[model samples]
Target: MKRFEGKTVLVTGGAQGIGAAMAKAFAAAGAGVVIGDIGDAAGQAVQAEIAALGGESLYLHLDVSSEADWQAAIGLTLEHRGRLDVLVNNAGLGPAPAPIEQCTVQAWDRIMAVNARGVFLGTRHAIAPMRAGGGGSIVNVSSIAALGLGALMEVAYAASKGAVRTLTKVIAAQYAREGIRCNSVHPGPIDGGMLHGVWSDPTKLERRLSRIPMGRLGRMDEVVAAVMFLASDESSYTTGTELTIDGGAAVQ
Candidate 1:
């Protein structure tokens, strides 16, 4: 049987990038997936692709920062998929790289709202259905920035992700007794999507690669596999921990 057969996964910011990738992977693994994102077109396209793959999925218009959106999204997930088995807090904001001094208040607030508060809201709302269903897993997509590796480039973004990292631990600890598992995945300069601009530039790309012992940026599938592990029964004993997928960047 497929790994996620009969399970339901809700992926936030699943319209594109790593979010879309995770949604497709979960559905292909046999989970009924909910693609939650503000980008309606891209989100629907991902849902369609999953359908073509013979996977079950639906797109939901969700602004992760909004509690109202979270309520509606979760409501729809239960109404359609029957139960919530996993919640992937994959939506986040990456502002242009700026030091703390240059990072405007507006940028900080916006980043925190989407990256930090959004994860908080998603986790908070998902707990009930997950508990009602007997158990669930929540995988928050943090960043190597949260570990101080990328802070020099984006202070606000790093701070926001730091919040995600700790928040994940809190959730894991409080919900373990209820059979809920919570973990965070920290990824370094991924090769495409949000980090494409960095990889697209020769100077920046070389600089990033030089910092990593692996000498290459991470891949989307690499991160996806890690998340799948955490969300699956394979990680039944794991909770309140972090898995870093940074190609040794954190060690350097």
Candidate 2:
């Protein structure tokens, strides 16, 4: 499915986890992939893997919270790919669950910087290039916490993701006339290192699984597929919307 043939996609936090999965999937779909992350070794490894799959890719050092890094990433993408067709604001920081009383201001600020502000910077910079190239898609990786459908264990993380959800809608509304589409994905209890603590503890794992109606954690590939759909042309009419990949967790 070479749906992204001739397109170029820039994925922030493409060094590992869901971001890495999305990068590889996009490359397999025929997009020239640009992996933006501070983790040089892992990012380069993902890039190499894409190359091995017979796809074109580039790796760039990016700190999502840094304005300078955002500018450099966007510039590098344009310089290398000549145009940007998709932007996935996937870089995020999830801190250990701490109640509001126990959570420090520094921890809150740090989470907001990466999860919320990072999406802002990426979307802000990607607009011009996309607008110039006849517009593009922006997929913001939010979480079920934004919708008040999670355990609400981390207030700051929930707040940050809520901001992402709102920002995505606003961008979609503001740029629709220009042909730019913005949407968000809300994932719940994905089977990744994000929940290592819960995975290692039997009681915690059982409790977590009990909440999801499907009784299982989501796979990284599931989230990747949702992002791919939102980024692809098949979703031409979709914007300002959110696709939740929570395995019925949100319902229960």
Best by TM-score: 1
Clashing pairs in 2: none
Cα lDDT of model 1 by residue, 41-119, tens digit: 9999999999998999999999999999999999999899879999999999875776678888888899999999999
What do the candidate models score in CA lDDT, each in turn? 0.92, 0.93
- Kindly give the stretch of ten consecutive residues in candidate 1 with the minimal lDDT sum: 147-156
Model 2 — TM-score against the truth? Answer: 0.97
lDDT score, candidate 1, position 169 = 93
Q: Which parts of model 2 have CA positions greater than 4 angstroms off?
A: none
Q: Which residue pairs in model 1 clash with each other?
A: none
In candidate 1, position 172 carries an lDDT of 91
